[model samples]
Target: MPAYGLRSHAWPVTHAVTELIAVNAALTPGRELYLSLRHRDSALRIVVWDQHPRHADPDTRALCEARRSTALWLLAAVVDDWGGEWGSGEARPPQQGVKSWVLLPQ
Candidate 1:
């Protein structure tokens, strides 16, 4: 984040990634977790993918309202925007996974 002139966002970004990893690990023990960071002209994107094919999608309104995890709540508050989707087996040929991403404006 600092590399992209987003020094102020570094801590929040790190916390978001750590929280995502922890949540994935707790929910799907032993499953693989993947993290990706991308810098765009206007935003920085942080994504975490986990090998939990059948887990609930993070996009549902009900899940957002019912979420009891303080880490997730904090993550949502810190990031400018966030969302997730379940990767299709055909699209993610190597493994079916759930992808969660946070976007912070640059």
Candidate 2:
């Protein structure tokens, strides 16, 4: 995996990423970061999760077909921070497929 770039509290977003990595690593040994694209370059996919799954946008409610708010903005921020085009996808649990994506520009 690429090294965690910049280390400055001024960049809360970057610092948050580092903290998330550390927490995940501590919580789940060998599973530090949720996404790892060491294999190759390709389009990306992202599936966010939350306990409550409904939304103010009736359209999104229909689109996601979810239960509570899924923090879509936060998801986008993460993807943008990581330099990738963002898109939505359904996540079927109890064997939901993978949870990472690649967004190669056209």
Candidate 3:
């Protein structure tokens, strides 16, 4: 995907990368993931899409977390330190997947 208006800030970049990894891990073996970056509403928005419409079950998520505590911790740290917002939900429109996104102040 094409990227635009991305900044060089370390925390946002780190958060984005970690989020991408999380999305990739959540995808089924043969499925694909999509990414989008944009500047909007005075913030930088980063989104990652995966083929699953619903989030993984708690047990599954916990299993993944156990294997990826560092990256997930870093992602959480950045969002908490920077006061940014992040979430995942059903994708819009005819899309058949989930969109995980982060909005960091510019």
Each model's RMSD to truth, in Å? 5.8, 8.8, 4.8
Give the per-residue lDDT of model 3 (tens digit) for 1-106: 1244444555576657676656455554578877787777767777877676344698876554454345455666677677787765667877667666777776
Candidate 2 per-residue lDDT, tens place, 1-106, comes to: 1233323322433433443344334433543234432223333222222232335688866654332114334544654666655443333575232232334221
Q: Which stretches of candidate 3 lie over 4 Å from their true place?
A: 1-11, 53-73
Error of 1 at 59 (Å): 15
For all candidates, the clash counts are 0, 13, 0
Candidate 1, 1-106: lDDT as tens digits:
5566778767877877887788767655897888888877677677777776453665653353244244366666656343322111211556556566777666
Measured on C-alpha atoms, candidate 1 has an lDDT of 0.61
For each candidate in turn, the TM-score is: 0.68, 0.30, 0.65
- Indicate which candidate wins on TM-score: 1
Superposed by TM-score, candidate 1 places the C-alpha of residue 41 at a distance from the truth, in angstroms, of: 2.5
Give the Å error, residue 66, model 2: 7.5
Better of 2 and 3 by TM-score: 3
